[model samples]
Target: MNNKEPWLAVNLSMLFPGFGQLYSGKALKGYILITIEAALIVSTVALWVQGSLGGFLTGFGGSILLVWNLFDAHSSSRSGNEDSFETSRKAGKDAWLGIFLTRILPGLGHFYMGQAVRGCAVLVLYIAMNYALVLLSGSVAGAILGLAASIAYLAAACCLLYITEKNPLRYPLLHIKYFIAGMSIVTIITFSGALLVRTYIIQAYTLPTGSMEDTLLTGDHFIMEKLSYNNVDSTDPGRGIGHGDIIVFTPPGTPVQEHVKRCIAVPGDIVSIKNGEVFLNGAKLEEPYAKGETTYSGIEAGRIEGTVPQGKIVVLGDNRRNSLDSRGFGYVPVENVTGRVILLYWNTRQILKMDFSRIGKVR
Candidate 1:
């Protein structure tokens, strides 16, 4: 008769779908549930990356499945049925230890369970997945690949839990030593991968001021795509910064601070501001996004007359009166440009709630 703890079964499923069923000796049912969960996760992620509204709604379905899995696991454990995986449990294999080791690194739990071949395969697959994630980061393909890798890793852990010898009290202290070693390796690889992705692929930033009002607001959290700005080609406007694009960069005088502004004029363009209206190449420039007035006094007036120097661009904030942009600090070198703002994912204006409507493409 099954003598498993219901609480333990619930907790196992909490870690990942189907885990609790495996713990309850329902191996076939657990595997099927895991496969279903994986498919749901992957499809949801793929749809979200493609900017589909259905993906957002599908996420709620996944959450509902988790609740059902938890309930099923608890009920199965409480039924007192015969344990199907009794042989492994009687052999003194600690399922919890296997789960813990796999949490540290996908294949470590398999090694602990004496499945060396499967363990090696899991490790190799993990390494390859991470390498691919780094290469494809900041793109639609990257998002889908990252989700697939995560699902695969979790599935591998569930597999370990299913086959691992149970009864934690029988194992020696040697398992702890292996866990520590695996954790150290995983930590190094994880941090290095995150650093590479953040540095060369994408990075998150929060707007600190209403400089780009209406377009970007204070407390709006957004992601910037660094790949497009890396090794930019000045001659090809399509590959680099261009007129009307919102960019994050270090203002000319503020080397330590970053600012977000709209590129008003590019190199070789004659720029002049007459009574707050901008003129580019002797023609009136239309700016529907810009607000506020530009004062003709002091340094602001001096910026009114100039041909954008080579390798530099003129930038101005949408909220012109409140911003200290190229008008006050002069031209910004192209090298100071960091990245283009792509997605605004969150807003922190309300301390207790998020403004979901504010989340969308930066444009």
Candidate 2:
């Protein structure tokens, strides 16, 4: 026994991790770690091949296992030495303080175990990466990074468990500290992405009806720029729209309903609907797409002639007879103009019915 180098046992344990378990006659545990570590390595490589290298499974789980292995090795050192491994019965005031701070801050646990630079690096990297992920992809990516940091924390607790054999519950406040630290990462990430960073795309509306047919058809999904209507420029609706521009507007009576039509008459222009034809500025508007020579004029039956009011646009659908448009509901207020219909996405029933070759590009 005098010839036995117990420090060799410690060094070997520190080198390979779980070797300390082998030294303690727990060969089963040592083999388990080895098996798990190898399996994770293989799986990580396979996932990288499948193009999920940056995914949560690879980034979070791989990071955790790496830190866990390091901590396991560190704890295994000085395992059997009486002087070096002797644990205090009172749990020691300073030792408890170190553990407490480590619990409060990620990677601080490793620092408390005398791995200073590594601890600080881990803490800084974890925070910076988490912040970046939130900024780019919102909370989804940030949460994964947090879970990885937590695995490191678990490794530290497991090390302490190996050394002290004390109940972690006895350190209730410290346990809360670690729990909060891990949760703090996720909370910051979620809040920053949701409120501060603003990584989501703006909502755009699609034309769901054919009231604006020939310009914007039913089932045509067009992109409306939210930024265009954000600032109301009442003086010159031309700040956003000009002659010949197809505009989308919410009619005066219903705030939520949207109507798309071509701007034939701007503010102060006299507009008249006569014999089913639109007479704008004293000239019969020649719209090639207006299908009928005589409009049913039924939809706009009660409509009367008037000059387009200031800050109002006279918008009409190309389908003169069937549309519920400016003639039916009156002029559209300039403030209600959403944006010009930019693109036509997909016509729902047009798989083999491919009359329109236009698919993606804005009209």
Per-prediction CA RMSD (Å): 10.5, 17.1
On TM-score, the leading prediction is 1
Q: How would you encode candidate 1's per-residue C-alpha lDDT over 221-291 as one tens digit per residue?
A: 87776766676665753347789978889987788788999998887889988877888999989888887
The TM-score between candidate 1 and the true structure equals 0.59
Model 2 C-alpha lDDT per residue in residues 122-223, reported as the tens digit of each score: 678668766675464424556565555455554553343234334443334454454345445544554454343122212245666776666566777655
Count of residue pairs whose backbone atoms collide, per candidate: 2, 0
The residue pairs that clash in candidate 2, if any, are none
Q: What's the lDDT of the predicted structure labeled candidate 1? A: 0.73
Model 1 misplaced stretches (Cα beyond 4 Å): 1-174, 234-239, 350-355
Q: Once superposed on the true structure, which residue ranges of model 2 sit more than 4 Å away at CA?
A: 1-203, 228-234, 237-239, 293-296, 299-304, 351-356, 361-363
Best by lDDT: 1
